[model samples]
Target: MAAAFHVRSNSFPSRPHPQAVHVDEQLIRLRSSESASTTSSSCIGQRLCDLQDLYDSLEKLLRLPVTEQTIDKKAVDKLLDGSLRVLDFCNITKDALSQTKECLNEIQSILRRKRGDLSSEVKKYLASRRSLKKSFQKVLKSLKATDGDESLPVFGEAEALTISAFRSLFSFMSESTTPSGKWSLVSKLRNHKRVSCEAQTANEFSELDSAFQSFAENKSENPLKMEDVKRLESCVQDLGEGIESLFKSLMKYRVSLLNTFGH
Candidate 1:
């Protein structure tokens, strides 16, 4: 029996598994790239996708029996706590994204009718955007407050990276919605010329803001363009989809951790 077992063990060499360090490295590279890149919708969408991929890899690593065995109860508790906090962040982000999309849809609907004045709808949309921005700012503040609290040997690196990514995401969202002096800048640009360098360099949200601002200021002369609304809608749709996927991944990771460590 011993000879047979020994032969079987030799026949099946141990398979190599993914290491936490590898995921940590990927997260680091992602963070570095994100910092250097513009916070355009495309870049943010890609960040969301990359974050989901990292979480998928993390789920696989955590599911490994060897990895789970190495984590003590104390570590598991810490991970669980962190996981819950992340889930909260994910939920809040999803809610905000949904609200923003709804506002976009409402604006598009109003624009489609070629109505006399879109000031009311535009005002509503801008108000919604401001509210969402405030929500994101609050979430970011909470995230910042909890930074560096997690120092677990096994999972601290992953948790820190996750928090950092969320911070970047929320910060981008906040800025995109309500950049400082965006209204003043738009107003100045409108007085000088219809299109300028500033408009060319602005992101989708900024462009949408300018469109709405123009429509509100001079509805009869400068109507809310359907094309601009459509473009903003597309951008928001992509972001919403990305956030939804990331939220699902987070839930999966949290559930897996709970199943493994909740006992």
Candidate 2:
């Protein structure tokens, strides 16, 4: 019996622990599902939740003595670097969401009072969005430049997925809500009709953009609607809450990894 048990244990010498295998499967499923569809706020939120779960699983896995010993110093170093980048991305995204929320709140307040020059407020908000887009572009360029190697082990794969998810989030945010080319107010009014028709098929960001665009183009005749402002405020609040949760998860995961491997 002893000899039979020894033979059976040696037979699975190279196989990963069951929990580790499960985590790998989770990663594969996440990557496959995300790749099969376009990015949306709902999808992004789901992905963040899934990633947080994965990180929690990984933290548990790292507690295993075999997992800790299996990971080399080089791999740990890679994880540390990747963790820093992930945190940076999370912070940038959070900042963007916060700034957007603040701007929308200001617009909402102005609309509620029906007193201020709504057009000027809309312009300020648009300008802030433009600045945000520029910042996202720069960060995205750097992300692409550094994304050449992703051959690390399980932890490396997780980091890559985190980066990819953030890239998609940033790309989605950077997209123009309005159509290309500058239009005269008359032209904008004409385009607004088409935008309205398409808004039903649009994402939250697009909906908010169309609302602001319509208001900007017709500020002389139509005041900024409170309903539109409220819709956008709600969207920002949802995104802020999701990102904040993911940020906390990422921080905890990074700290856990550092504690386990930083020696």
Candidate 3:
């Protein structure tokens, strides 16, 4: 009868007791479900953040295409719901969580290495492209001066030229085909009858009309008066503010990705 109560006096815990293991597994399942919901919520927030970051990274990855950001919807989805290797990742059963972590870590390690290589490859590509561009900077400046409106040997087509140089220098730009390949850019120059295009044409000469007035106000070698520069600066400032807001979102997502995955 005393044996029925269990006679082993060794306080040493045996390998996961069958009943304990069972209970642990159940707990793990429940926790996983709850965490999943939180993770989903976090993802929604993260996507918004990523969208903003995409905006900021634009100037950097301008060659990719504007719609498809560097972090991207896929990466952001992985950050939130994908089988991520998390640190202190699970609070399920000690045994089950430990095993899950082992599996997750192994998987993440492989991906981590691959991702690093891909990033380096992309970065190197950009650097090489930039070097080539610098060799032609003088030629490009000349073209801009004359408003050549034509492509060059190095830059390819006129529109294409803007994107390649803009990507190398400013970046914060592109998607499939490249930034300038966006439907918007293509469409901008598509119809000769577009209202905006017509408006722009009319305004092109407006600057000249203001030139004499500007010269009278303040003489300068550049026909564009101080007011024009001021207006341009103001427009740039607005763009900067939008970029800033987007940058904050990206930073937030980065923090979440790092923390959640135990980066």
Candidate 4:
């Protein structure tokens, strides 16, 4: 009877540990997923910092003085070199991003399934990258080289001249609005397109207008200082903001004149 009982017990098939096998597989997947997430997150974080640095460099380059008086070729070249280096770094980052996209996406998917924090960092990286791209485009358009010239084309020169001219014209118009006497510089300008003024107030307008015209004619003079350029740029930007469509037409006309006369 004892031998028979022992034989029956041995005959029972050994049950497979299915639950233990599943738990082990789950643990392995979780660990591999976390490892990949850490690596991708680190790469993205480093790239974001690099992009921010590039943005700063671009801002610095854009803010440099470009007035007729201070547009130094050598100095501009140095800035351009720095900017190009940043641009190159951006290219490298893009390449790295492309290469790691599959791994990043995999990690992203895993994190999303697990409701992880690293997913948010990935989203932030994408947003910052877009912002950096937009900033680079704007600065590039503003500083585009013309006619294959190494230096930025003198696009601002015409704008500066027009701004100065408008400043004078507006001053003279104000005097005309509240005339101390019967005639003023504005009256002369209105009656006969061009006229010389002798009044102290009129002379001030006259001098400003004359200086602007001279600067337009002789761009090599470089009489404009950094402050002068900044003021003119600000004035032009303000007017454009105020009357966008009209400003565009006026700017087109001014640009045409500058192009024809080589200001």
Candidate 5:
């Protein structure tokens, strides 16, 4: 007998944009013997498509100016909507991965029971499972750090920090940290850490947090000047590069793991 699984694309909530990009729902039926290979490949394909769509949306959003006058609020809202869709899709992918991992674990357990031993192939399969989980975790962390929670600021505090970091990165701001800009002072309250684990990224994020706090203190603000807009644009470009690198690493590992099932 074969088992059947259906993966559906999630529809987004209404926003400024009336329509969201369309993604197809996929249904895959797997024979008992083919369950591992078939399900893994099908799910991987669906996830990849969703991720590509998200990357495209972000790339488009990245083009908009940060300042008020020239800024395209409509485009910004559209991109925000797209980001929410991506978040939903990633959650779906995570669920599918969980189920797949559980299925593999069950099979591994049964094999161990029947043979009273684990073979070389079984060991390799288990290793792949662990690797997949780690890779997926990285993907989730990076996306959440960039996408941020739903709030008025659009770019969440973390994103604000990222923007702040970019200003310093481009030498648009002084290198000296404002009193509020210290990581311990600012980041201790935040739950999420910097997207990348590296020290340099962390330092950049710290700078951003400080800069954002300073901005907050100022209260009154003006539309971004042209120079500010250009600087923020450069910042987004830097951020996008990092995001692309993370996604590429995740895709490569995930595909490699699925291939272990000989897809």
Candidate 6:
């Protein structure tokens, strides 16, 4: 276990690349699994390092005269080739990172626009809110039965409550030292006093609050609210829309995250 932890904390091994590009303005897109993370960033950092090493070595060689083949031509060629391979990997890493960033950005934009539709400053839309509540309830019900083709990660209840306050899913893949673990993402934390007995690893949508909270980004001290709508009706409508979109985004995120870690 300790060894696994060390592996998580350690950097990825620098892989070799062949026939690397020399362009300065190039950028790579990020993969969903790699976005908003130190793990992916570490790869980028290593690539930069390899590039710098190559530059330095070339500079030294330029200044030094060719006397009796310094350290054998073949060995030098191999070293240079290894460095070049790493450089190529770095380029690919950059592209993957960029793509992930773009995907996250797109998801955010959709939510933002939907949020914009919720800016009416009134609070008495219980009817509309209730309608949305029902829609989500139905969605949850279906999920509870495992009524269709699917799998689910039911984070036990206690941990979810913590998520409610924080509004962010902690990345085990990025932070975890090991590649494997039994509780990669716990559904709940049981030690807390407020957590209910029913917060066990249930399959129902009763887990919604905690389950949903795990995917939220970091929450500030002040909670988010709606703003800028022509009427309270639109605000209410937008609220439902925004929430629906949120559910969609989270579902997507969960899948992407699993796929990433699975790889």
lDDT agreement of model 2 with the native: 0.69
What is the C-alpha lDDT profile of model 1 across 28-106, one tens digit per residue?
7666645653444555566666677777777777776666655667666766788788778778777877787787777
lDDT of 5 by residue, 47-153 (tens): 23333443343233333222122223453453345434444434434453344345345444644465433333334433543554465555555555765444222
Off by over 4 Å in 1: 1-16, 19-25, 150-154, 176-201
lDDT at position 52, candidate 1: 74
Candidate 1: 10-residue stretch with minimal lDDT: 183-192
Best by TM-score: 2
State each model's C-alpha RMSD to the native.
10.1, 9.4, 26.5, 35.0, 24.4, 20.2
Write down the lDDT of every candidate, Cα atoms only: 0.64, 0.69, 0.29, 0.31, 0.32, 0.26
TM-scores for candidates 1 onward, in order: 0.76, 0.82, 0.25, 0.21, 0.25, 0.28
- Angstrom error at residue 28, model 5: 27
Better of 1 and 6 by TM-score: 1
Assess candidate 4 and give its lDDT: 0.31
Runs off by more than 4 Å, candidate 4: 1-68, 107-263
What tens digits encode model 2's per-residue C-alpha lDDT throughout 6-40? 21134335776887787877788668746855455
Q: Residue 105: error of model 3 in Å?
A: 53
| Model 6 residue 213 distance off true place after TM-score fit, in angstroms | 8.1
Q: What is the lDDT of residue 37 in candidate 5?
A: 26
Q: Rank by TM-score, descending?
A: 2, 1, 6, 5, 3, 4
